[model samples]
Target: MNQLNKILVLNAGSSTLKYKLFNATNANKTLALAPMISGMVEIGEVSKVTHKSHGENPKKMELPDANLNDHRSALSLVIDLLCDPGFGGLASKSEINAIGHRVVHGAERFKNATLITKDLMAALEASIPLAPLHNPANILGIEVATELLGDACPQVAVFDTAYHSTMPASAYLYGLPYHLYKDHGVRRYGFHGTSHSFVAKKAAKHLGKPLEECNFITCHLGNGASITAIKNGKSIDTSMGLTPLEGLVMGTRSGDIDPAIPTFLNKQTGMSYAEIDSMLNKKSGLLGLSGDADIRNLQDRFRAGDKHADLTLEVFAHRVRKYIGAYLIQLSPRLDGIIFTGGIGENSWILRNKILKDLEHVGIVVDKSKNEVDLTSQIMSVESSKSQVPLLVVQTDEEKSIAEQTFQVVQG
Candidate 1:
């Protein structure tokens, strides 16, 4: 029998805890999906909780809403399900070797997955201003996990920003004066590093090519989108910067807007600074374009001749195409292919077809029929005799990557 390292991977979002229990040491299958569990919590209304396993139907149990809601109770519930033998828990909590928390912002302090220590938690807290919405919950997860598991069970911080730390000054820096960057640490700090890294490696696997021998433009297009140009095995460039708001058009984000527009809107409309900030972050993007940002619904509307939905899809594709063209120039001679992943990139055949439709001039082409078919392969490439730029759609697994890294870090 082969021994496997069990690492519970936790991706704590604002109101959702998306997790998977993975056997990190299984050479034949490095990661196994946990019974998926998620749903609303102490959010807008009362703190309502809904839970589920990956394969089971969602079951509900209610209690008085926790006044000061946070990740603690959520963590407790998670532990209970894992430890309770009657609940079909995977292991008797003790058998679970470690924890891996998906931390969105590690600032510059963390570049590698570090064992969650008090000192590390302190650093995560200090960097909260950089990612006020995300880092706090990440810190809460660490604190709660440490409290429950104690120092004996190793926990690791898998940072979303760490992989992009390799970006050079020219790629990360803005044209603003040097003092802003030096004094305030105000510069591009890419998010979704884990996803980009996962997709890059996955791309190589699909192409049957050594990662060191290939360079491609990787697009992680979901509601929150980011384009990355991976040179060989490393991240040469990516879309997200400073915060997640600086990239491609998302479900509800104003990506790549004029920096001065916020101030302009505030002055002209007598809107509060907070209001403008919230507007750009919460009420823009495809939502503003199509009257609804949902891809499925919006696509349905487009088929029914809704001009706005069509326009929204066009803008989204245009934004992507522009970036694809830009990255082509950036990696000119080394560009081998264009790869797409993330929610929309993985499932939406129409979007993929639209994005790659006109790229023939750039040696980028796709087999429409192959792309439309569904199959799980490392590489989802089109079978085209004359196609130059190899277009691929790869399914990414950032959580498994985190779990693998967590196991190694704990073992080492």
Candidate 2:
């Protein structure tokens, strides 16, 4: 029997932790009580945890409004809940044989899931400047897991930028000095690789073709949106640059702005580089365009005769359509279809419809009726009968992908 049958996947943020527990003995199955848990802890906020499991009622707990304080404290609460007789899934922490952590920036070094070693830990620390906001939290998660589970349980680091490591030099390079890329690792290392990779394989399976034989353009449209051009099962090009701030318009992120805008702001407004960076990453995008960052809110306002909302939706759709066209050209000969995933991509038919509009000349079509139907979270077809390129939508499952990858590494 495989000792690494139960796997735990953790995505730790500065103030939050999202986790999923999977029984991987028979194709990555889930526990009956609660398979996923999300917990939030901060200085002056009410700590909250939500649990969702298959074949059971979703449960939520509101902890005391006092400060839960740190990631370690928050993670302890999650472990407590998971081991609780009333809500826990496993009998003990020992049942979990392996843990998979989501590390956001792997630079150019880590191309695949890797076992966490002392040297790997040092490398992750060195790469901290590349992902200041994310890698620290990720490293903290691994440290806490190690402390709690001991050396008996193996820990794996599954990177977000790992899948896009296959991107060719032509696709990943910027028009900058060669020494920048060679010495400082300055290049377009796209984010959301796990999501893009999983959905591309899923798209191939749905089309009844081998993943290696298919081509696809996957748009992971969400708060942090990105588009990827997949050629023969590998990422050839993607929207996100060295950081996730490039690519499509996103919730609060100003994507694809003129490279000179930051300098212009600094020169004109006397804003520091840090201030301009914060504005672009936090104050721009759909939020800057229409005073709201959530797409659902923009969509609701657009339907109710809001002109500003209408324009915001148009700009968002236009950027996505533009990328779709470019990626199509990049993967022209064997172009399969365009896929929509993530929050907005999967739920917002209005956004998806606007994105695919008038692309009939390019062999892309949308079935108006099917496109408008509300889908809770299932993958369904919304392609028109005449479309040479199918429009596909899938709810991206990054945790599931991490769990499967962790199992593979452990089994090997």
Which candidate ranks first by TM-score, i.e. highest? 2
Positional deviation of 83 in candidate 2, in angstroms? 0.3
Cα RMSDs, all models? 3.2, 2.4
Tell me the deviation in Å of residue 97 in model 1. Answer: 1.1
- Alpha-carbon runs more than 4 Å astray in model 1: 26-68, 84-87, 375-378
Quote model 2's TM-score.
0.95
Candidate 2 ranges with C-alpha deviation above 4 Å:
1-4, 27-46, 56-58, 64-66
Q: lDDT tens digits, residues 190-234, model 1?
A: 887888888778777777899888888889888889998777677
Each model's lDDT comes to: 0.77, 0.85
- Clashes by residue pair, model 1: 35-54, 36-54, 189-242, 363-389
* Candidate 1 displacement at residue 148 in angstroms: 1.9
